[model samples]
Target: MNRSSSSRAGLALIGVTSLVLAATGAPASAAPALTMTLSSTTGPGGGATIVGSVTANSVTPVPFPAGTNPTVQFQYVGTTAASSACSASAKVVSPIVVSNLLTTAGTLTVNPAAVKRISTTKIVFQVPSSPYPVNDANGNPSTVNPNGLVLMGGQTSSRWSVCVYDSDNVTTSTLLATATYTLAIKPTITSILPASSPAGGGQTITVNGTGFAATSVATTATAGGVALTNVKVAANGNSFTATTGPRAAGDGLPVVVNAPGGTVSSLDPDNNSQTNDPPIPFSYTNGISITPNQAAAGTQVTIDVIGAGFSSLTFDAGAAPIGSGAHVFLVKDAYVANSNRGVAECTGVSVIRDTELICTLDLAADQLNPANSATMPGVAIAEGAYVLTVVADGGTGAGGSANPTIVSSGATFTVGPY
Candidate 1:
């Protein structure tokens, strides 16, 4: 008798689970039996008035008694979910877009004028193009709004499911159909100046575009899988400047740009309408630096020169006195003559990736010129700061001979008495 009772208990539990799984006003075990069609998939500002139709597939009939209309509403959550947001909320929040930012914790607020029942299987919707009162959704008093993540925070897009409910939202309401909408505004790029730069980065590039955030930290840009640093947008929100990071020389690499976004809409599809989706033909040369810069002159010790695009810098025989028209020099801070520089001791070269170089450079006695060693005379070596420079002919994008193939970045190396 006990065994029979246990079997009966298990069947009872299964029936209870089924009823909960098919709860009304919420998602059910059935797949979305609805499809939403909009005039366009993208638009500017949550302020846009989207005219769309929600059609049911295998779902229940939305009862539209000649004078009655079922509710057609939007349920939104961060399209990009985060674990922290589930437990903690923001301490401070910004003002949000009024039209489309709805919350789940309070009374569902939707203007009756926004929806119209055309048939049994479909309902037409016209989202409010004008602003709604902020207090309407928060019960006219509460400050907490779940949709704030997209409207007031940094999230670019919130997943919105256009839900169709038969009659009022209650335990018995039949959920007909729901679909997620994809809306975006493409940021236009007018141009990217200085068309080309070294793959090893450190190049300051100016990107001109419209609809920028001006001073917001959300504005960012990248090229060739390398991030842009110190990104600052113009006060007018039309242009910005940033420094590039290291990247290997390649034929094609994606150029990405981002701006302050996430209000009733997406940050963007991240497509630049002007430059034809990533302006092409970027030129790269070579850039490198050295480590442990404080070394005495005439020191034959192994010196480390590290930076990116070093593979573009080569010697016929990675050997001492790399004389393949490739030269590394430690030019005096007050350089006046050729001898005012030290022919860096690059006795050996190591290769792995383009970002670093474990090579040897001879720190010969650095000299300084009063006028010219041939004119007034010069000092054998000066103990001061010197800038490291390289001459890599035929580098990655080494443009011309008059300018050499590589334009290395300036790295300071201090020199002392031998």
Candidate 2:
């Protein structure tokens, strides 16, 4: 008979069998035994949704035994290739029973309560919340935190045989899926050579720092309210050298070093920590100079000093010379008096030639006055005679003083139309 015809005939037989089984005591031998099948499983933590069907050949409505609690136990058998057995055993994830098989000729619907369906045929069977530690196919403990499904047994059996369902049928559980991650750390800056120098275009500064890779480092300089450019890192990746481009003279440009990764923590020359915990600070040496012993009134003179440590250099006129030294004045124009009106100016400066300080000056108004320019320009006779001061306002030097040896007694220069 055709499928439809067969189904109709089966229903008729089911009715007759039901009546007979209800009346007669001869346990209806014609009734077929119900069977279950598992379709699919899913979700994290080894949770699985199983799809199964209850089938019997007889037309009698096979009422699945009551109190029949069917449970799915998952054993974490070692990988198939593993020589030893899985240390962790399996436990019942989800327990269910065949509720009601309405018909024997058609598909039997298993209610949601009977089997939690994850998808069409895919059902998610609840697994233990605790992770199962098992060995992988390679004999290694599954490093995948909570290893998932392990297919054991049930190879030939219709993906749903009770014979295959039991633990006896299972040989070893095969790992199915796992979870996927990266590691990171911090960076630092160490030391900068030539800690002090004159500011302006042409100063080659070296910045040192660890963990510097490729173009991961940079340096910047700001002096006299101006920002310099062309910051670059060395090829070695440990140092960064660059020249100050067009900055005002006597400007103590604060050089900032930025490196890949993070902040640096190393002992500097002064034993100070370059880490800059309390104060993120760095040090650099520059090569520049300030000069001149004596000058006539209204003379535009350029002070030339040479040395390193010019990175963060500040200049002040009211600042005192070396020792109980004389007071230095920063003149504006060639007409200013010896008045304490010492205007602090940072201009016409360049880091020309190595680390040399190049600055231009316009004589003060009353510079020729007896109390001013009239008196001989106090000669800086010794090497340490001239010093670079880096104070907020007439403050002390940041990198101390550089004493240069004075070779000449005194040189004369005209400042005005005498």
Q: Which candidate has the highest TM-score of all? A: 1
Q: How would you encode candidate 2's per-residue C-alpha lDDT over 239-349 as one tens digit per residue? A: 556565533243233444333322333322222354334322332222223456335454556766443333344443332222212223343222112232123222355
Candidate 1 achieves a global lDDT of 0.49
lDDT of each: 0.49, 0.33
Q: What TM-score, over all chains together, does every model reach?
A: 0.41, 0.29
Mark the 10 consecutive residues where model 1 has the least summed lDDT.
83-92
Mind giving the per-residue lDDT tens digits that candidate 1 earns over 186-255?
3556666764556567889887766555421266677665777998887766677888787655544445
- Residue 14, model 1: lDDT of 94
- Show where candidate 2 strays beyond 4 Å: 1-4, 7-190, 199-202, 215-228, 245-256, 265-367, 370-418
Which pairs of residues collide in candidate 1? 344-362, 345-360, 345-361, 345-362, 346-360, 346-361, 346-362
